[model samples]
Target: MIRLDYPIVIEPAPEEEGGGYRARVPDLPGCISDGETRQEAVSNIQQAIMAWLAEARNLGWSVPSA
Candidate 1:
């Protein structure tokens, strides 16, 4: 498995519901993950990025240059 070692930035957004944190990675389009807590949101984003990269590689898509 080819692993990509890069950095991802996560920013907090105002929650539409009662309360929570929203995370988004600018470098990865449509790559947004959120959770009730800031820590959780960031952690989920990392998992999301890993999955995205794996799927992209499997589909023979060009991995976005960070």
Candidate 2:
């Protein structure tokens, strides 16, 4: 199994963007998720991180370090 620890940035979504919390892994470009609450956004981002890493591996892309 691949193991990675990356920094995440969580903030409120813009009012025009539906008002949920948004989470993203800066080291993994385009890896993002959102939820109605901070906790949920965090959980979703964890899944996003896994998916992002898996895809990178599948494509033989170098994974960035935290």
Candidate 3:
């Protein structure tokens, strides 16, 4: 069985620049998502990660070899 582990980091967007939420998966390079609400962003990123993993598996691509 192959198990993948990753860390997700979410932070609030600057209020001055219009409040929102931003999320990033540390283990996946260039994987980032933003949303107008924190919950929306988190949910979106979770799906994004799932899709990304699926694609990686389909293409036989190892995740960053980490």
Candidate 4:
């Protein structure tokens, strides 16, 4: 299996925003996920990365390297 690593930025949700975590992959443009905890956010982001790669492949889009 080809593994791709991308830098992710995880930010805390503002208190007004309900208090959770959000993770975003900068290289994947719009590839993001969120959850109620840091662990969940990271896990969700990993799933997002997989989905993003799959969609990119389906559309014949270029996949960037880590």
* Overall lDDT per candidate, in order of appearance: 0.73, 0.92, 0.77, 0.92
User: What TM-score would candidate 1 get against the native?
Assistant: 0.71
TM-score of each: 0.71, 0.90, 0.70, 0.91
Clashing pairs in 2: none
Ranking by lDDT: 2, 4, 3, 1
lDDT per residue as tens, model 2, 1-66: 656578899999998989999999989999999999999999999999999999998999998976
Candidate 1 stretches with Cα past 4 Å from truth are 1-15
- What overall lDDT, based on C-alpha atoms, would model 2 receive against the true structure? 0.92
Model 1 weakest lDDT span, ten residues long = 1-10
User: 1-66 in candidate 1: lDDT tens per residue?
Assistant: 544445556555665564677777776677778887889887888788888878888989888876
The local lDDT score (0 to 100) that residue 37 gets in candidate 3 is 90
Model 2 weakest lDDT span, ten residues long: 1-10
Candidate 2 has a TM-score of: 0.90
lDDT of 3: 0.77
Model 3: per-residue Cα lDDT over 1-66, one tens digit each: 333456778999889867799888888766778789989888777777777777888999896643
